[model samples]
Target: MSASPAPKSYAPWLLMLPALVMVVVFFGIPMAYMLRMSFNLHVDEKFYVPGFTFEHYAQLFANPLFTAAIWTTIKLAFAAALATVVIGYCFALIAWLKPPRWRFLLVGLALCPLLISEVAIIFGWWMFFPKNGLLSYALVSSGLITSKFSLMYTEFAAFVGLIYITLPYCFFIMLSVFDGIDKRTLEASADLGAGPFQTFVEVLLPLSRAGLAVAFSQAFIWAIGTYATPSALGPDTLWTVGYLIQDQMLNKHNWPMASAFSMILVAGVAVVMAVTRSFMAKRQAVHV
Candidate 1:
């Protein structure tokens, strides 16, 4: 016909060029630099030699503080992810079951914490948790306790802040999954004399397992990498890997060690993501 329009192959590649450039410039270069730097040796207070060595990585495991930080990071992330999943599931289920008109309000309320910046949220909680803040004032004023008591600088406060920050992600993820589920299934289960708990355990939970895995993984990764909220709210002893990374890079001026810690964090997150993907794939296969 008219030379068959000469094919459109180059157009797609041209369209993708910008994205490729951005990725290389933003991600690939930095990642390569970090990996290279991780192999370097720290010479002194302000200098790191460019020679390749595994000393940084070796020190990461050999140092008791670093190992403890790894354990603490895992423990906090796991606990926060678990709590977020359970609470978010309940909240999403309630919102999903409500009338369409009420759903908007429920989602809005759930989004309130997310709408605020993390720093602002932390500050708000900081004020509310201190001895002179509203919580203590109210308890003392209402005769609930003899004197004002502070909840600040406690593991509980850190956990609360972590859960608050991550809950919205878990909620939206489960909410989307819940939207795809048919309410008629619940009705059918009820018709078959299944109670609410039975329907949830048997039908709802199984159906949303993939979303749960994804949400939990995301929350865990976030918690693991977060340093500010935990550091501000938790006691000094509650050191996390993220805090340690910052400490190594900024306070100690140890670039190689910082890079090594960052690489380890990245590896841990990657492993979590890989496991989640595998679990989700298996779940999908079973359903199929």
Candidate 2:
């Protein structure tokens, strides 16, 4: 007798169809609509009709305000990501170097911010940067400053807030990466007379490259999407892409312009993500 034929595998594809449909419907459709809208005109405080014009794109490209906003957004995001990664590395190293009894506690403390909401984090920083808040009060009490000096509505405050908001996520990523590293290697490096700095530069950093990339990308992406924290913490001139989109959508009543800004922001994020992924893949390949 002939052996029974093997069954075909169509069930997994069938199961995935709903998710595919949902993505196409929700994500793809909106993206395409926005892309189309970006080329259309938003005339005279009315509905966005389908007139194909490059006016919006031209205006966006020509406007110095948009250009400045893009630059500011990039600067803020990059700065915040870098700060978070640096602080997070130190935090993770502390957690890794500690005894097992203290390891979990250190990691848990690093991750507490991530457990809280963005609004809460913003509010906490808001309270801390003002004259009546903890930072200014501490400075006054400690005799560091003669009087209560507020940091609120400053670029420094915004940067601090952004770093604080993103540091927990960066710490957790680095901590997980650090956990995978063999402590024996550091000991061996020390046995070979390598200094702590030298060992970190030669061994720990190279191994943690992937984690740094991930943490940077995560923080940068989050910073790009954040508007409220910067708006609340910094000066009025601190206009990001997020703020631009929000203003266009709500304050200006220009949905098409808002869609255009949204598309640009998405494209900017995509480019950054692609570059980061490429760099990460190259590092991984080299390491492997």
Highest lDDT: which candidate?
1
lDDT of 2 at 96: 87
- Give residue 25's lDDT in candidate 2 (0 to 100): 100
Error of 1 at 114 (Å): 2.7
lDDT of each: 0.91, 0.87
Q: What would the per-residue lDDT of candidate 2 be over residues 65-142, giving only the tens digit for each residue?
A: 998998898899899999999998998999889998799888778778878888898888978989899988888889
Write the residue-wise lDDT of candidate 1 on 160-234 in tens digits.
899999999999999999999999999999999999999989988888889999999989988888889999999
- TM-score against native, each model: 0.92, 0.90
Cα distance off (Å), candidate 2, residue 23 = 4.2
Model 1 lDDT, residue 135, Cα:
93
Give the range where candidate 2 is weakest over 10 consecutive residues by summed lDDT. 3-12
Per-residue lDDT value at 49 in model 2? 66
